[model samples]
Target: MRALRAGTRTLDLNRRIAVMAIVNRTPDSFYDRGATYALDAAVAAGTAAFDAGADLVDVGGVKFAPGPPVPVEEECARVIPVVEALAPHGLVSVDTFHPEVAVAAMAAGAAVINDTTGLHDPRMADVVAAGNAALVIAHSLAAPRTQHPLPHYDDVVADVLAFLRDRVALATAHGVPEDRIIVDPGHDLNKNTRQTLELTRRLGEFQELDLPLLVALSNKDFIGETLDRERGDRLPGSLAAAAWCVAHGARLVRVHNVRETVDAMRMIEAIEGWREPVYELHNTRPEGND
Candidate 1:
């Protein structure tokens, strides 16, 4: 039985799956682009997701893809208000690799720091430890905002496992407790579609990390390419991949579609015997037999 403690929200991953709904404040993010870039829209999106069944909300000001550099101050500006506003609703995780932004977000009420760059700046870990905030150390082979063309790996899963193991140790050594840390395989971050699919297939191996595993697979190119579908039409594939990962051992799923992901996860949990039906009296008896 594993539990993830993000501020006051503790999730028992043993019997349930946690949904981290995406609330990107960046205007150029692959999904939703500038839809939620506005402060009001972003907050509304977060609030709506929470109402729809999200366990946590991840707020990011910068896109992971290579783009014009957003200064630390600008990044802070983009997410601080959203974090301060959303913190009271539930757990809010600020996505950034810069230690300065991380600390600011923490001060503004963010309970978790989701660094997609695999904690590239070691100082980021110290900030998390200082605030007693949860840290999400994701595996990314390239630096932030930099492209890695045709990145090759001897074994994608094995390599990712090794990288995460080392990063976990580094984070713990920097004063962040193991229980306060979550690891993300970072599908499609640096790896191509094939590697991302492999990670999805063998996600159970990440369980060895002994901590909650987060997979950010919402409308990613891997699903789109595999199904020959566009971003807007990849919900089915995304849900299918998410269900597979949930069955394989992913504890948290970062997604764009909250309702569908929640429904799929609940269904999967029921199938896995980790959850029970809310109403068991649905047509169990034959017509007029009851």
Candidate 2:
């Protein structure tokens, strides 16, 4: 049985699937586009997600898209307040690849540092270990906000596995415990739609790593392109894909629609017998009390 420990919250991955709600404190988020950019709004949104069944909230101060470079001070300013406010409520994971940002957020009580860099900055492992926080080493071939047009891979899943394996070794060597680390395939990081789709279909391959898998597939471009739908219209596809990941081997799902994702995941879990129905009385009344 595997488990994830994040600050005050610990999740038993062997017993059930977990949800990590998204709280982007940036003005150009692909989904909300800064709707939750304000400090108070970000806190409120995270609080609502926690109430709706999210096991944790991922607070990101910057978008993963290319734009102006946000200074370290500015990034810390944006993330620290939200982390400080939300830490008391539930698990809080700060999504940033910068070692400086990781250092500050952990000091502010973030349980996990969801670094999308896959340890691009080696100092990240040391910084996270110093805080005694779990580290999410997301697989990404490109630097955050950079472009890798028409990226090619002989075998994308195999390539991702190799990358994650190397990063895991690096982290462990830095004194980060094996149990305190997580891995993410980074749905659309640098891959095209076809590659992302292939990755999704075979994400179970990641289970070989033997670490908790956290898949962030909410309203991503791959889903949009595959279904010929826009960002807002991709929930059904996102939910379906999330369900598949959960059924296969994803221990945690990072998502935008917390309330709805929780609903979908619980239903899937119930169907799979990992979760029990809230109540079943449609002819289940001792099989006779109609």
Candidate 3:
């Protein structure tokens, strides 16, 4: 995989896996409801995530699930401060589908704009390109802030890949450089548990696209349903899915639990031979004196 350059931060996909810690500034987000909704709380969470070894922090002002539309100004007010506070600490991404909000976020020191709407807003790419920011285009079938129950596809993985390819093309055409683009399969968004499972199993197929593949499968409904676990008890399942995605060619994993995901990814790196122990003494050869 090629390296991804998000403004000033460049992630070398070939040698390292990136863990994007999720920080929701929304009160009604699926996870962490109202925990970080306050500006001070959000800033603290972002700092905490960065200090915990996250390669990047993804800050979202609006919830992905169907809900009332958060006005562009409100969304900006919610996330821009958090982004500004965290950008100096580490790489930061603002998750929003509104073009105006994207522009405001970039101005507020965000290096990446993560649009979960799959670039549904035609002007979003232009706004990102103007700011010279990185773009994360997710695969969601429905419109932003809307519901699509029981969404169908002839072949889930193939369909997702095709949609991502087209979105990439659209983004590039709008002046966003190719190297600054990342693709996400949007696990659990507009997909059933079975479909999400298939996507995770076949995530490697997306490698053909040649961009960084980001999977946001942390504590999602699929894991809960698959393991019959509740929201707070899905860490094990989330980590398993993360490891599988990395093994299957995913370069980035977005999650709520940073420390656990960081540890898991490090273990994966060592097991896959991408990394080695700091000092291996258990099997070292004996010296001449010995």
Model 2, range 161-214, lDDT digits (tens) per residue? 999999999999998988889999989999899999999899888999999999
Worst 10 contiguous positions by lDDT, candidate 1: 281-290
Give the whole-model CA lDDT for all candidates, comma-separated: 0.91, 0.90, 0.91
Per-prediction TM-score to the true structure, in the order listed: 0.96, 0.96, 0.96
Give the clashing pairs for model 2. Answer: none
Q: List the residue pairs that clash in candidate 3.
A: none
lDDT of 2 at 257: 92
List ranges where model 2 is wrong by over 4 Å.
286-290
Candidate 3, residue 93: Cα displacement in angstroms equals 0.4
Instruction: Report RMSD for candidate 3.
Output: 2.2
lDDT of 1 by residue, 1-290 (tens): 46777776677889889899999998888989799999999999999999999988999999999877899999999999999999999989999989999989988989889999998989988888988679999999788888889989899999999999999999999999888899999999889999998988889999888889998998999999999999899999999988888878888999999999999988888988888888776567676334
lDDT of 3 by residue, 1-290 (tens): 77888978777888799999999999898878789999999999889998899989999999999978788888888998898899899889999999998888888888999999889997999998888689999999988889998899999999998999999999999999988999999999899999999999998889899999899999999999999999999999999999999999998999999999999998888887889876766647676333
Best by lDDT: 3
Mark the regions of model 3 whose C-alpha exceeds 4 Å error after superposition: 281-290
| Candidate 1 accuracy as lDDT | 0.91
